[model samples]
Target chain A: MKKKAIIYGVSLGPGDPDLITLKGLKILQEADKIYYPGSLFKSGLKSSYSLSILEHYKLDTTKFEGFYLEMDLTRVKVNELYDLTFEKIIEDYNKDLKIAIVSEGDVNTFSSFSYLLEKIKKENFNVKLIPGITSFALAAAENLAPLCLQNEKLIILPRVQTETELEEALTHFNTVVLMKIKTVMNVINNVLSKGNYSIYYSEKLGTTHQFITSNLEEINKRDIPYFSLITIKK
Target chain B: MKKKAIIYGVSLGPGDPDLITLKGLKILQEADKIYYPGSLFKSGLKSSYSLSILEHYKLDTTKFEGFYLEMDLTRVKVNELYDLTFEKIIEDYNKDLKIAIVSEGDVNTFSSFSYLLEKIKKENFNVKLIPGITSFALAAAENLAPLCLQNEKLIILPRVQTETELEEALTHFNTVVLMKIKTVMNVINNVLSKGNYSIYYSEKLGTTHQFITSNLEEINKRDIPYFSLITIKK
Candidate 1:
């Protein structure tokens, strides 16, 4: 039986190329065209950490297209990029070509796939999202950390805007997972010193330069990357 | 260099055998023994949904061991099962055999690994947790729904006991993910009728008996499974 022509969005998982699920791997292979996100530099060439993971698999490069997502988060710019990306996807969809949209982490998580999905809904496009492993899961796994246990509340916040927010989570939840802490490290540092807690930190996980640590001082000594995450457990 | 022998805990994703990460698959194949969890019926036979997913891959059954975990959550019984399981793992560890402890979803997320991990800490065991695709991720992916987005708080609660708590999350966070909703269908059903919010419900995801829907009424029509989950999005 022939599978119907449609668009599929797959998560590559975090870092290690081998983390990609068999279902995601199969969709990537079967798709006629694969679209992935990348940051376009001033030189007009794009570089994508997500694409670099694919290098391990060494999939056919001819079928892949990189959507140059700029670093600026201006609403107009962001909307334009996704809108244009959808335009190209619709073209392929109209031709009955199978399309795969690739994202770095779980497509359901805070990833580019969400923006694309919103556009997909408006057009009534046939799309399937293949779930992938989340970075936080891998980060906790590598460190032998429990994300949350029986009756434990897990709050995954993108930012710890204030010390109060961090403190509230620390007090109320059994475990707090804070992501993209590069800019809000101060709030975390203050709360850490004020309480008795265990810290597990990972940056650029699954890559060659990956860093993992339990010592807060060790992490404080270095510049935290945007991909860095910490599980503050009590 | 050959990968060194260690006790590895790998998540089998939710239901689909193919949803297991490539790394998890490789570890399971190479392990000297693979241990999974299930219930031992009065008939002296065991049934495990996690192991059933493995049947799709059709790995060697001889290498598998099913630990009988009672339906009861008594701490004494729970401790006994994991303690004995760890004892055997240690026996294999002493023999320098590579071992894999299998769980259904992400090992880091509210699974038996946390209980086993507590036991491992008593003795220095060379162990690694290989994260797997989470069922919630699969649930969201299937519905083209976003678990969370920029600056949105994502609260994952095993129980939403009160209407106030559910309302709080839906009001503050962009998305609230509730797992194991089988027991709390009444509370959910109450909120569904009161609000104009969107609901994405999933049960036995990626399995033959999988149920998924955005319609709250359709869910009320059937008996909710224990594995069911819901995401209330405002």
Candidate 2:
């Protein structure tokens, strides 16, 4: 009888390598193989946030085989990616490999790793999800504002698809954190204009290129980046 | 001219010493003074979660001067505690100290350190808030559930005061994380029963005394503790 391989869902924590938890860092450094689910943007490998964080920390990646789980959903079918990932993970499991899927922020928090983990977990492989510092928390610190005080409600809208939902969330919650608002910024800005919410915007938090602005007017005038986050307090 | 004291807000990260970020750990190790905002429990000094995490990590406490910012609001007036904390901080500033306030989880996310930082920042002191892994994130990972799917809304209700608020939040958001639900567990449980939501319960996450349950029935029957949290997916 052979032992099944263990899969670790490691969170890199925002953009700073230093922000990665000791547990996460340990697993990343000790993993037999590292797998990063690259974004569907320009170049999948180039936009791999986790790999950049690992490189920044100067972890010896050459010691292990690094794999990029590139799934361009827009260009390829979802089933194709799922089947490919399923087979890849199963193959590793047969080899008794200790694989880690590096994710941004907490692995269980609106992460792409969630989809892959679902497929991996079905095979009854040993899996562990290591939590990390969330980007909203960093954005809150960058702006020197509490995400929510005592008894205050905080709504985290990863992507506000509808204007109606945005209006409702803004009205109901004490604080609203809008993530990945790049594509829908125009619509979000319009809905935000109708409300009397104080906004704090941050892009590429914890990185050298990090930007912060408390002025909603400034955020409205700028070209919002893909990684940008907006915090609105009522 | 006297140099202002530098204050660092260090987050301990979800009650696990290993979960502390490298940046937070480094600051904790090098801090000249460590100040922990004690809880109003049995003993102010004994109930410091950050201190326990430090001890768990086997960090030496002999090198630095440790201070307990004992602000028991239940027993003492807020103004009195605020004044005493202010005076103590100012006195340290006079000595040109580098004090670190050890906070649990992200300092900017519903932490008691926020109040102290507000006072310290007003005095033009240099303060830095380092982020950490939040308990809810850990709980989600423990239950192997995603906090928020691609476009799903997530609401973090730190302290749910009113039943109406809980109803609205659960009804609107795809996921609702209710923290510090000790007092309102019965009410929340009653409301939770009405929805077809899957619940994940965790108490003292990442600590040795940690508890996790997917069964809402068991959670409802048990005595909810102060450190307990409930995550509901709609």
Which RMSD values do the candidates have, in order?
2.2, 2.7
Taking all chains together, each candidate's TM-score versus the true structure is 0.95, 0.92
Count backbone overlaps in model 2.
0
Candidate 2 lDDT tens digits, A75-111: 3565566577668777877888878888888798778
Tens digits of per-residue lDDT for model 1, B97-119: 88888998888887877888877
lDDT of 1 by residue, A1-234 (tens): 324668898899988999999999988888899998989765677789878987777679898988888775678887898889889998888878899999988988989788888888888878889998888998888888888886777888887799998898888778888998999999999999998999999999988899999999999997989888998889
lDDT (Cα, 0-100) at A82 in candidate 2: 57
Model 1: CA > 4 A from native: A1-3, A43-45, B1-4, B42-45
Best by DockQ: 1
lDDT of 1 at B55: 77
